[model samples]
Target: MSLRTVARDDLKNAARSYVVLGVVGVFAALVALVFVSERNIYPDPYRTLFDVSFMTFLVFPLFVAPLSYLAVAGDRESGVVKYVLGLPNSRLSYVLGKFASRASVTLGAVVVALLVGFVVALATFENAPNLGRFATFAGVSALYGVSLTGLFVGVSAATRRRSRAMLGVFGAYFLLVPFWFGFLPIVNIGTVLDAVATTFGTTVTESTRSFVNALSPATAYLYATEPVYSGVTDQYPQLAGTFGGESSRIEAQLWFNVLTMAAWGALGLLAGYASFRRSELG
Candidate 1:
């Protein structure tokens, strides 16, 4: 079969899987809650929906890791991938096909959840939802989820053991990425040096903590969506203005967030393909 056909078949198979269905349900429920609760706080449905959805996706990896960690690792462990490879498919085609299928599934789930949010907003609030803004949010949120899925799938493909692959992806999401954010404060040697310089009546330098925050995909997603979520009400004052256009040191440029997420997905797929190409199944 052609690679496109292979990809289509993979998509169908994933759509039927219980795990995929379960993830979709969880996302829909979360989005629904966000919509139902925020209606009372924000004056407009669009703003309420946008705020909750965008904030929920800030840690998008947490939602994506479980579904993607077993994308290839489970098949590889069960020896099913070997037979599939024997069916006139190159390793690269297989890898690409799986990536396409998983990304599609991730995107579909996000759209459904967004739709649930939209419905909830319509039912609860008197103000009309902004279809245009909601559409934009859905597209960006799906892109973020797919990017995270690719990263986890790559980690899964690289590992021989299914348990290791699963644990590794979870670790990368819960530990490594968070560490990237947390370690910045702990190791702000530059800031410390600047303080020392100030004590000496010398020029003080600024630290690159913002650049470090932008390095995390979660932070990048949050920064990119900040432009669209206006009218954050007083209910959650702390979360208000989160989506404002004001660029701080930690906020990545809008273009940078898009590029960083795309780069992350591409790099992860490439790494997985390379590893799959070289490794022996037996």
Candidate 2:
């Protein structure tokens, strides 16, 4: 079997999973809730879209972590990897196939959730949702989800135990999502930095903070979508910096945010494949 065969089989298996179904359902429901609740408050289509997209950015890693953390680790723990590798499939094919199938699942969920948002907007709002802006948001969301999938899939490929994989991915999720920004005070980097800055009267540069935030896939996703909210509304805050402004810092550029996202996927895949290739299936 080639990568295509593995991917096809994996997709079929994922389709039958209740966890996948639940994640997709929850994601769609959240988007719908945002649309229904915020429609009256934010009448502008772009503002509503920003709210929905921001909500997605915050919760995306939660939805994707479960779908991806067990992609290969579960198979290995269950001894299915031995039988699968006994076929014509190489380790590279297996990893690529898993990535493709999981990425497809993630993208599929994004599409479903966004479609639900669009339909709800059409029904509840006076003006129809802007198709171009909606499509752009959808595209950025898909890229963000897929990038995160690659990271978790890499974790799955590297770990032999399911528990370790789960811990690794979710631990990553907390660190990259909540704790990165001081939602959890004790462990939050941002919070710690703020305390230190306050105590020492040392200030962190905006460029430095921008670079730190750009390190996260979630923040990078926000940075990449900044252009969509450019002229529409000021509701969406800039995560990286001003896009295409006069700033000479690389973090201020739109291309840097886009590249940050692409790099996460590529680096995760390469790192996972390297570790997986060295693993002993026996």
lDDT of candidate 2 over 125-224, digit per residue (tens): 8778888878888998999999999989998999999999999899888877787755775677776667788899998777777678777777778767
TM-score of each: 0.84, 0.90
- In Å, residue 132's CA in model 1 sits off its true spot by 1.2
Please write out the lDDT profile of model 1 over residues 89-205, one tens digit for every residue: 888888777788888888888889888888888788878787877887787787788878888888888888889988888877754365654546654434555577789998643
| lDDT of model 2 at position 142 | 93
* Models, CA RMSD each: 4.3, 3.2
Candidate 1 regions off by >4 Å? Answer: 183-207, 230-251
lDDT of 1 at 266: 81
lDDT of each: 0.73, 0.84
Ten-residue stretch with the least lDDT total in model 1? 243-252
Q: Per-prediction count of colliding residue pairs? A: 2, 0
Number of the top-ranking candidate, with TM-score as the measure: 2
